[model samples]
Target: MVSRRVRDIEYAIRDIAVIADQVKKKGKKVYHLNIGDPLKYDFKTPKFISEALASASHSGKNFYADSLGVYELREEISKFLKHKDNLDITSDNIVVTMGVTEAIYFLLAAMIEKGEELLIPGPTYPLYINNTKFYDGVPIEYELNEQDDWEPNLDDLRNKITDKTQAILICSPNNPTGVLFNEKKVKKIIDLAGEYNLPVLSDEIYDQITYERNYVSPASLSKDVPVIGMNGFSKAHLMTGWRLGYIYYHDPENKLLDLKEGIAKLARARLSASSIAQYAAIEIFKTKSNHTVEMVRKLRERRDYSYKRLRQIEGINCVNASGAFYLFPKLDLSGLKKWKNDKEFAIDLLKKTGVCSVYGSGFGKYGEDHIRLTFLPELSILEEVYNHIEDFVR
Candidate 1:
């Protein structure tokens, strides 16, 4: 029998793809805009990074790596953080994971006791909520004001904190919404965590994929708060399938020794991330590459075009995304009375128009009446997707 915990976990982002496949078998074309995979679009990984992986495999570097990570790769990551965010992280403080997904799992597994609460943003990436439930922990959601460009509501966040709260999670260049939390908001969250003596888990996988100026990492701004910053090459380097990511713990006062040790224990149990990928990731920090710059430029064009198109639609409205590649547009269902909710509308749209998008309610309650779409497709494809959506809505 499956455990109740396993049965209770829900991943809405990929769940709709099952229905999409059934549609495809019936001779319909499906434009996959549901997932945040850059490779599905025009993005490509850098050749140097791929060549490094090939060379490492050819040269017998396939042995099991250190549980924490390949030391050289960890060192390179430390240096990259220093250069990019002015963070003084060390190799010893980093743990390599299969991806940011694993990093989140390890962090939650190590920190969350049964019934403890994790304060997360509503309409968040589903992983945080799912992982919390997997450990029998409670997920407390704070609001993200759509009227304020998806900025987190600090007052709502403060009200949600209780003695049972274990930690706080922040996803800058956030998934589903593509909203980047500014420096002021980041600092306020850190302050709240510090006051409550809770650690902060920062997901920065899309840090380099921003359309605007570079974002400030919360760890860099933190003085005494314990921060666990998670990042990987999946989004920025166009290496989602490679499954290489790392988490760095920063505690200036050494207060989080127990939490750090817990993460290390979990890392050892997993053995290590991909050895070949680690060696290749080392090459990523060593070489100067323009792949990310070019990728962001293309994404910016798509984002602008799609945002403009969505706004023109009579019943659709969305805030312009400043970072990442998603736009969560609110749908006015009054005009089209056939659908009951966003999910129903999304599935019907898929059947009728062949555009696959995840409904907003799947993210959280605040996500109701909205649908999340990736602007990752090229301009021409996006034009077609929008035309179909506009027609479907009308």
Candidate 2:
């Protein structure tokens, strides 16, 4: 029998991807705007990082290392966090996992019990939903206000709180929306967590993917409210395949010691994250690559281009994306003849024009009228895809 968990699980990001694959098998050229992988744009990983991994492997550093990641890499992570985010964190607080994906899983496993609830942002990355279900934890979604540049409706968050609420999750520079959380909003969330005695899990995978704003590290604002800082090299460093992610548990009150120990136990059970990847991760400190700046420049250009073209389409409304490479544009299908829902709109658009985009409803219930499109492809491809979408909508 399939497990109840399996029956309940759905990952809309990759789930929609299966249809894209089916389209490909029919010999149609699908312009993929589905996944957040930057390497798909023909962007090469930095040579120094690759060289470090090669050196580590050839020098027989392939064997399992420390369960909580190598002390060296952990130290570098601590310093990086301190320098970049100004967090009063150290190596002792860091735990390296396979990726931020695994870091989240480990953190969730440590915190949640069956039937408990996690307060998560709606139109979030789908992993939060699937993983919560995997452990039988209920997800209580708080909607982002579309009318307010996708900020969380704090009253909605206040209303959703229950005794079963275990933790609050925030994704700044949010997936799908690409809206960076303002300091006031984030500080307010932190304040709420403080009053409720709930820890906040901040997914900061796209911490570097911002423009015209400084990304706030949630942990930096609190010494009392425990903050679980989740980050990785996937989005920023173009190291998606490397699977290197780390978590820092910051609690001056020492409320999260048990949680940290639980994560360490899970880390030990998994044996260790890739030792070579850990080695490669440390070189990020040593190697300064101008490639990242250029990548961000290209990404900003693509974002502006996509936003401009998407707005020109008759029934589409997109808020200007301030960070990351995605645009969660609302599909105003009321005027359109062919579609009633975002899923049908996205799938039919793919089938008709070979442009692959994810139905925003997959992100959460709040996203039904929207579609998530990645701007990871170059400008020419984004322009072409937008052209096809404009034609399809007509």
Candidate 3:
């Protein structure tokens, strides 16, 4: 029998990838808009960062780094956050993990006790919910305001609070939805955290991938609340395979000392992250500016074109994402009595039109009638995928 801890865990994003693999085995070409791996779509990591990795690997700098991270990477990360978000923290406050995925696991395990609650946004990244369940913690999802371009509903959020709630989890320029949490909602979230004396675990993994709105870290805006900031080089730097991510503790009232200690203890048990990747990260922070700007520009163009095309389709409702590389379109399946849910819609579309996507239910119940597709592909490929999806839906 499988352990209960391992049951009920599902990643719909990659689950469809498994189907795509099977389809490819039959010599069929599948157009993937499913996963967010940029490298799979011709977005190469910049040469300078790769050169740093090469140098480190050859120079015998490949030994185990500090448990949290190498000094150079940590120091660069501190300076990088200071420059990017104006969020002040030293290297000591940071703990490096395999990726934001691991950082999320560590944070959930450290903060949530058995049967305790961690508040998360509905239609979130999904990893938060899975990790909470794995750690024997309950996840309480407050809805993101889909009616208002997927903004945060503070009243709904406040009503969801309970004595069991430990921390509030957030994702800005969010996944699945492809929208930022609004400023007013951001202020209210921080205020509630302060009032409840709870920690705010903010995932800023896509902080630099904005199109219209300026990116601001939730940790930068909080006054005295403990902001457990999670970020990484995966999205912004095209270092998905590098598997380097970090978490920082902003325990202004010295309230998070024990939690920080617990995180570091876990870090020590795991030992160091990839030493070569750490060295590469040092250079990545140094060389991130131009590459990021160009990438964002390209992504914005793709976002605009894809949104326009999706909007033109009948029975499709989209929020027109302002940031990130996803287009989450709500399909009007009222007339299609054959399809029962988002997953059925997505799977049938794949079998018929060879366009791959993840269903909205995979994210959470909030996205039940929707499906998320990435615009990370080249403009031509995106145009083709959109055409195929539109024709199939019609």
Candidate 4:
């Protein structure tokens, strides 16, 4: 028998991979645009980082790490925030986990009681919604206006906050939509959270991947509000398989000590993240490399090409993503009487054309009629993928 929480959890990003695998068994090639992993395409993890991991492992650094994290790595993260974001965070306030996924799980477990709510963006990364459900917590979605570059509808956000709301979650250069939130909106969110005396869970996983300059962290802008900033080497450093991420607590007043303790307790329970990866990451943060700059340049080229081609399609409309590698395009299924929803359209497209994509509704309620696809593939491959999608639509 399955538990209700397990039954209700739907991670459409990976769920569609099963179908693609089955389709591959029939000798059809599947263009995997469904997931956001960059390494699956043209990207490669830096040689130095890999070497660091090998050196650590070879030297017998194979034992379990400190549950909080390696002191040297956490110290690097602290200096990273100081230099990059100008946020005065110390190593004691940071806890490393098995990626931001575990950081989120630990946060939910520590903070959410049954029926409490987490204010999150609609059309969000699915993990927030699924994890909240697993904790028996409510995910109150605030609208991001597609007509206005997917910025948070501040009025809608303000209206959604209630007494039961636990924390506000935001992902910049957001997944699925890939639109970066502007500075004015970021400040507004911090202001709102301050007014409510609530913590802001800021997911900055894609902070370094932006096309534009001057990306600000919510923690940097806040003076009194508690901002739990989450980031990792996965996206910025091309270390997705490393399973290393950390959350830094920013409470200038030193008010949220209990919450920090809760996270620490959970970290101790799990022992620690990958020790070899943590050792590698310490070197990653210490060294300055042009790898992300080159990665962004290539990704931008792919993004531009994919966005232009998707816009040319007759029945699709997409907001140009400024950061990250995803493009969430609204599909015009009205004329296509055969497909009832995005899921049906995606499945049929995959079966017919061997192009795999995650349907929009998998993200949240507001994501219906849309299909989220990544622009992480090479231009030549993307050209073929778009051609198949256009033909399928026609």
lDDT (Cα, tens digit) per residue for candidate 3, span 1-394: 9998888898999989898888878887799999888888878899998999999999999788899888878888888888877878999999888999889988988888999998999887889889999988998888987789998778888898899999998898889899977877887899998999889999988888988788878888887999999989899889999898999887777899889899899999988889999887888766635888888988888899999999999888899887778889998889666699889999988888789999999998888999999999999998888889778877
lDDT score for residue 283 of model 4: 90
Listed in order, each prediction's TM-score against the native is: 0.99, 0.98, 0.98, 0.98
Task: Write down the lDDT that model 1 would get.
Answer: 0.91
Runs of candidate 1 exceeding 4 Å displacement: none
Best by lDDT: 4
Ten contiguous residues with the weakest lDDT in model 2: 286-295
Which residue pairs collide, candidate 4?
A: none
Which pairs of residues collide in candidate 2? Answer: none
* Of candidates 2 and 1, the better by lDDT: 1
Clashes of each: 0, 0, 0, 0
TM-score of 2: 0.98
State the C-alpha lDDT per candidate: 0.91, 0.89, 0.88, 0.92
> What would the TM-score be for candidate 4 when compared with the true structure?
0.98
How far is 29's C-alpha from truth in model 1 (Å)? 0.8
Q: For model 3, give the 10-residue run with minimal summed lDDT.
A: 280-289
lDDT tens per residue, model 2, 203-239: 9998998877878888888868999999998878889
Superior candidate under lDDT, 2 versus 4: 4
TM-score of 3: 0.98
